[model samples]
Target: MKFADIGLSDELLRAIDESGYNEATPIQAGVIPSVLMMRDIIGIAQTGTGKTASFVLPMIDILAHGRARALMPRSLILAPTRELAAQVAENFEKYGKYHKLSMALLIGGVQMGDQVKALEKGVDVLIATPGRLMDLFERGKILLTGCNLLVIDEADRMLDMGFIPDIENICTKLPATRQTLLFSATMPAPIKRLADKFLSNPKTIEVARPASRNENIEQFLVKTSERGKRDTLRSLIEAEDIKTAIIFCNRKTTVRELAKSLQRYGYKAGEIQGDMDQSSRTAELDRFKAGTINILVASDVAARGLDVKGVSHVFNFDAPWHPDDYVHRIGRTGRAGAQGRAFTLVTPSDDEAIDNIQKLTGYKIPVHGGGAPAVDVAQPDRDEAEAEPRRGRSARGGRGKAAAKAEKAPARPAPVAEARPAKPREDRKPRNDRKPAPRHDDLDGPDDGWNGPMPGFLSVGFDT
Candidate 1:
């Protein structure tokens, strides 16, 4: 449906048109009307389905006529990460440009002074991460009593980051009569409980099945050894027709290392991870969106709520530990009704992780090279068996060469041993009267005298 059919104001429709979107996405179409009517909402849709605009557009129109009081915001949007909060704030700016709605961003990795100042001046919309918002609230820098609309974006992510308690605390601080909206890619048990407790008889709108894969994305699992992952990834990047891509790693260190490796290989790559400051992360994301870097290596921080358009592919450098993450990571591509591809490098150790993803998504991902999955434990045994004959042949050749060299050399005299019986203790010499044993080094030449027959074990022979 078009934005005009969603009952948005003429000014908001104009902004939407200017933003090059006439029709509303599924989530947006299902949500904007409920939000405009001041009804509670529980929206479940995968990432990149325009979930941000569903609430942002309606909230702008709802707050356009309200007067924001000092230390209090007319609407509150709680995001899981600093990047996601900033993205939501950007959406507000982009879609609310035609209106005079004031906005304030409260997130970590930056000074709280500016945020406090913004609160003192009042804001129509306040976008924040749970931690930073809680920090400011504890210091009395902000107030939630005046907020009548509360949106908990990325609810499942909040649960994963252990921010549910903070969200509940924030909810208690707000007016009980407020209209709350909870949006997530999947409605897990905890997220469902959160919505049940906070939202009052909310209209649950699920555009697609929870954790469903986008049909526009062609997903493949690339089998690779742990040591061969980088080489395989480079080969894929070079072989595929990529416009832009995001490579996801489980750890921030991996993200940094992968990004550096890609750059060394002459690919325009950048990284964004939790260790980086907010400004640095924002700069890296800006570089990615502006095409300064065609590939972005990132941690789970960018797995959700990052809206970069025209991403042609997504490469899972490390299979995500959580099944939900696989969905979100791949969802980075195939966005906005665009066709894209996703390749996940699965090592032997990632069997469990890949299995969990397939189970969650209810479909097995096709193998990249058209063979069985790569997590076979017996492969090493087969490799060792194939190498055994070569090892045996090498050993035989070495022995033959040694035997030939020995045959060419002159034979040395064989030493003999006497078969004398043990002497009686009385006939033994005293310790002080005993002579020193002859040292082998004392003799200038090999002994020519034979004491007795040579021992059979002392003879050397080769395998003929």
Candidate 2:
């Protein structure tokens, strides 16, 4: 049904119009009315189904009447990642523009002072990541008791990120009588348990079957070595008549390195990971959505709820470790009824991952043998690495030399006296003759908070 047919406020309808959406997405059409009627909701839909607006639009109307108090937000929306939280906050601003609703974004990697100020001014809608939200709550900077409407977006992701405990804690603080809305791309047991405990007689909406893929996407698997994955991705990007694509990687280090490699190869690419400053992440996403950036190399943070349009391809630089992620990664393309393509780079080691993904989707991704010559995987230059001074090494004569000397070298006695002056045996020591150096203690530093240079997923754009 058209958004206008739903009982949305004129202002919201106008915003939807400007967004160029007339008919609502399945999830939106199902959940919005129930949310508007003040019912708790458990929404099941895959990524790119316009689920953000399912809650954001109705929330604006419900919150339009209440004024937020300093440190006491009237409503709360919790997201699994900082990027998702920020995007939710953006939706509030976009839909609530005509209304005077105030909102705040609480996430990590930003100055807390600004968030505190926003909380103090009384926010009508507070969008937050679970970790940072708890930090503020403990500091007495945010009070959850007054929150009437609660939204836990990406509930399954919350479980993946180990935020369930934090969510349980937040739930204990909220008013028991408040309305709750929970949305997830898939309903794993953990997420379902969360819904059972929090939602009261909720209306369940499933827009698509769980873990199913969009039929419009042409999916394929490229069997290659891990080292060849990057080269394969570059070739696909170069050869395909691609408009835009999202390249997914599993590790942040790989993400950063891949993005840099792509850019070095003269492709317009950027990186986003958990460790980046909030402003930089925002700027990167802004550039991507505006079509200025051809590729965004990110992590799982970009897998869900990212609404950029016209993505023509998806490149899985690394196979997803989690089977569910395979669905979300491919879901980035073939959105809005448009035909799209997805290519996954798999190594011999990824056979299990490929099997799991196939089992989950119930359709085997076609395997292609020879695409292009895979790029040479980089190997640490042993000579260059060894050239660096041996740490803690002393020029001490050790037993190693004696042992070496005892092992007789072949006697190259007298070279035939005839020709050129007989060359003396070169005295350069064998590599093993050097005494082993003590290892540097600093090399053991903890990597606990490392957010790697690049996020795990990358997106690039192309106009159809």
Candidate 3:
């Protein structure tokens, strides 16, 4: 159904139209009406299912009449990560443009003074990470009792990040009767327990099974040794003609290394990991979205709620540690019902992880023998996958300047015969029976010759 049918304001509809969305996604359709009716909600959907707009769109209308009071935001939305919080803030800006709703984003790595100032002036909406929000709350900079609308986005991620206690604390601080909406990709037992304790007779909406694979994405697992992951990824990139992709590594160092390696091999690659400050991470994301870089090598921190358009491929450089992470990693692509492809590089040791991922998602990803990259055919990398991929230049039969140089550069001149051969061992005397050099005391008294044990000078000082 259309967004208008969901009872959104004309201003919101205009904003939606301007953003080129006419039809409401299933989650938006299902959750928006319930949210508008002031009902608490528990929304269960996989990542990239338009969960942000599901709440943001309706809240604009719900919040239009409220004037925020000092130190008390009218509404609160909690995100697990700074990036997700920022994304939600951006959505508020996009959808709330017609309404003059003031919003403040509270996240770490940014100056608290600015956030405090925003809170002092009051805001219609406060989008925040739990840690930052709790910090401000304890500092007496912000109050939650007056906030009527609460959204907990990516609840499972919050649980995974050990934010549930903070979440529970924030919940206790908020007015008990206030409306709360909790959205999550998967409902682990702990998350379910949190929901049971917090949400009050909420309207339950499940558009898709938790951790279920998106049918729009074609998934594959490529079997390779640990060391062959990079080459396998390169081969897949060549074979699949990946236009834009995010490569997921298990560790922050791996993220940095993979991005650098891809760049060295002539791909326009960038990295975002937890090690980076929030600003740097945001900047890298901006670069990726702006197409300044076509390939983003990232950690699971970017696996959830990072929405970039038209990403055609996702490569998992390492299998995710958590079964739920696999869902979010691939969810970065095949977004908004767009058909996409994902390839997971599976090593022998990843058997259990892969099994868990498939079991969690309730589907087996097809196996790709490294995409059968044609030895004689090579596809040119586009945008940041630039120059020619290393595989294409070498084994894949693509001749570029680098390849030409490789062909033209002469092989090493035959090693010069080790300067002078091992001078014959034959010239060496064996020490097996050689007597110790004669002591001065044992030698004939003062031999006159130069070869004497004591050259005459040694004996001459003592006895001559």
Candidate 4:
């Protein structure tokens, strides 16, 4: 259905059109109408399904008539990560340009002075991560008692980040008569219990089955060794015509290192991790979004609620530890019905992890690129690992003592020999008269095989 038919204001519709969106996504189409009717909603849809707009669009319309009081926002939206919270704020800015709604973003890694100022002026909407919001609430910079509309977005992600207790605390601080909308990609029991305890009788909407793969995304897995993961990722990037892509790593250090490696190879790559300050993270993301950087190396922090359009490929540099993260990482691509590709680099050690992902998704990911795999070392199964060969002294058995004794046995005297004058009728020149051999690059013919000098990355304090 069209955005115009959903009872949105002309201003909101104009902003939508300017953003080049006319028809709503399945999730948006399902939740927009219900949200406009002031009903609590439990939306079950995966990431990248336009779920952000599902709430943001209607929240604008619902909050248009209200004036926020000092220290009290009219509506509250909670996200699981800083990146997700910032993205939500961007959406509000883009969609609410025609309206005069004031919004504040509360996230970690940033100073609270400006946030306190925004709260003092009051706001129509407050988007925040759980940790930062509570910090502000404790300092008496903001008040949640007046917030009548509450949205706990990415609820399942909250549970993963260990934010459920914080969520429960925040829920208690809000007025009991407020409307709560909880949205998630999967409905795990923890999230279900939270919903049952917090949300009043709500309208439930499931746009797609839980953990269901998107038909628009083509998935492939590559079996490679741990040492070859970088090489495999490079090969895939060259093989695919990726307009823009995100490379997921399980650790923050991996994210930083992979991004540096890509940069050394002359790719426009950037890195984002929890260790970076808020300003640096913002700058890197802005560069990525503005096309200055084409590749982003990130951890699971970006797995949920980040919406960047035209991501043609996603490379899992490291297999995710959690099965659900596999869905979120790949979901970054193939968004809004756009056809995309996702390639995962699996190593021998990742066998069990990948298997768990397949089990959760209920399908085997297809193998692609016929040839020697990027990583040839297949990890041994449990049984093989248990039967591993003995090592060192254990493997020597009874011969180790004799071998040590033989090494210390006295050596026989050498047979006397008269040194004979060497005959020098060979092609070798006299040592003093011979010049240095030609360097590899100076040799002639294609057989000489001259590539440029090595990058000297190791000398520069980086890994080769």
Candidate 5:
């Protein structure tokens, strides 16, 4: 159905039209109505399912009449990462352009003074990451008591990043009677518990099974050694003809390393992690979106809430610890009604991890063995894998054949059996020259079975 069918304001409908989204995604269709009714909601859907608009549209309609007080927001949206918060803020601008709803973003890596100034100007909508929100609240820069609409987006990722505590803290500061909306791609027990704690009796909306991937994405897994992961990534970028893509790494360090490796290979690649300044990160993302940089190597921080268009591919250089993250990572592509592809490099040890990812996505990632990659095929480093240091060099020393032979000798030519086989056992005096071994009973207890019935003589005498 179209946005109008969901009873959105004309302004929002026009904004949706301008954005080129006439039909609402199943998630938006399911969620908007319940939200309009002012009922709390729990929305579970995969990424790229148009979840941001599901709540944003309804929020703009509800918040249209409210006037926010200085340093006090009328509605609050908490995201797990800065990119997502910024994305939400952009949505507010896009969908709320006709309405005079003011919004401010409170996220780290950005200028706090500007955010503070925005908060001072009074905001009808506030989008923030958990950490920065807490900092502002603690420092008296923003107040939550006036917030009437609460949204916890990407709840599963929040739990992954340990933001649940800050989320709970923010919840306590907000009005308990507020409308609460929680959305996630996957729901583990912890996320469920957090939802149960925050959301009142709520309308549950799920357009698809949790942790499932979009059919628009064609997924593949390439088995490669750790030494070849970078080469494979480079080749995948070149072979896939990736116009733009986000390369996911498990660690920030790996992200930097991979980004450097990509740059070294003459690819327009940049890195984004938690450490970079906000301007640098924003510039890199803008370059990516503007097509100046075709590749972005990032940690899980970029896994969610990033809405870059035309991401033709997603590369997972390291297997994510949570399979749910795999879904979010690939969701970056295959968006905006476009077909996208995702490639993952797997090592022998990642078999279980890759299996878990498949279990989460509801389909096995097709295995692509060495051949022309659907993307460019970069030659693998034949000696790299063997060159890296092995984990915990064996205490026994290197096991090369030469080393083994040097450490052992052909059974020392067994001395020829003495020609005097006539020697009898008696003639061979007691071979064991050591003292006689103690008897079993002497070492343990008396052989007599009845000894346990009475106190031992040694015990009675010692007592006396």
Candidate 6:
């Protein structure tokens, strides 16, 4: 369905067209109408499904006529990360171009003065991260009472980051009669309870199954040793002839190191991780998006809600620790119905993590080489391969010379012993006839025979 068919205003439709989108994505088609109707919504769609616009498009029209009061935003959008909040703010700017909807972004890692000033000026839409928003609220820099529309974007991510309590606090501060919209790629029990507690009779719209893999994405597992991951990644990148790619690492340190490694290998690569300052991160991301860097190494911070178009491939340099992250990390590519490939560099230690990802996605990812079996089912073979050496070492007691000798030496037969005769008891001397043993004191006395200091052997012959 087109944006026009979703009952968006002409101004909003014009903005959508200018942004080069006519047909609404499944999430947008299912969600925009309910949002426009002022009903609460529960949008469950995987990443890269245009869920951002599902609410942003309708929200522009809803807040078009409202005038925001001082220190209070008309609508509140709570994103899990600074990048996601910034992305939502960008969406408002791109799609709300024709409308006079004021917007403000509240996130950490930047000066708060501008954000405070924006809040004082009253924004029609407020895009904020939970941490920064909560901090500002505590300082009386912002108010939530005027917010009639609340969007909890990436609820599952918020849960993962331990932001659910802050979200709950923000919800209570908002008007009790507010219309709340909760969106998540995968709804865990906690996210479900959050929606149950906050949203009022929300229309649950799921464009796809929770945590479902995008069909446009071709996912493969590249089995390699832990030390060989980088070489495998480089080989795959060259083999695939990747135009642009995002390499995900499980650690921020790994992200920085991998990016440097890629650059040293003559690839244009950039790094983004939680440790980097906001400005630096934005700069790196901008470089990646602008083609200054064709490969981006990132932590999970960029796994969700990062919309970089034309990402030709995704490489899991480290298989994600969380199963849900596997979905989002690969989702960086294959966005907007574009065909893309994702390769996970799986080491032996990542077996359980990869298994969890397969189970969560409900299908085993194929090995990079098509003829080989999938990684999930091939785990036993990997285990056996690893155990084979251990079993050999156990049987041989290691490869030492002694073990070799033990393996080669023949067993000796038991030797026969000669029988010995026992002495007759009557032939032995009587106990009374034996002389008393010399004492050490007697031997060391002044009258002792030729002794300045008794020899050590003589001392041993005497009893104490």
> How close is every model to the real structure, measured as TM-score?
0.81, 0.80, 0.82, 0.81, 0.80, 0.81
Pull out the clashing pairs in model 6: none
Model 6 scores worst on lDDT over the 10 consecutive residues at: 373-382
- In the range 1-464, model 1's lDDT, one tens digit per residue, is 98989999999999899989999999999999989888999999989999999999999888889698999898899999988899899888898899999899999999988889999999999999999899988898888999999999999999999999999999999998999999999989988888888889999999999998799999999888765677778878888999999999999878887788788789999999999998999999999999999999999999998889999999999999999999999999999999999999988899999999999999899997778534433223232333446667465554444564677779988788887998989999889998555444332433347344444433458788
lDDT of 4: 0.87
* Number of the top-ranking candidate, with TM-score as the measure: 3
Off by over 4 Å in 6: 371-464
lDDT of 5 by residue, 1-464 (tens): 97778899888888889988889889899999999999999999889889999999999999888688999899989998888988898999998898998988888987689999999999999999889988888898888888889999999898888988888888888887989999998889998898788888988898889977688998888877765676776666656676888889999878886787677678899989988888888888888888898889998889997998889999888988888889899999999679999888888888888888887777867777544344332334533333333634453664443454655756556578758657776756664875344433432354356333333343344534
Against the correct fold, how does model 4 do in TM-score? 0.81
What's the true lDDT of residue 240 in model 2? 89
Query: Comparing 1 and 6 by TM-score, which wins?
Result: 1
Candidate 2 accuracy as TM-score: 0.80
Worst 10 residues of 4 by lDDT: 378-387
Ten consecutive residues with minimal summed lDDT in candidate 2?
A: 379-388
Q: What residue runs in model 1 are displaced by over 4 Å at the alpha carbon?
A: 372-464
TM-score of model 6 relative to the true fold? 0.81
Clashing pairs in 1: none
lDDT of 3 at 251: 94
RMSD (Cα, Å) of candidate 1? 11.1
Q: What lDDT, from 0 to 1, does candidate 2 have?
A: 0.82
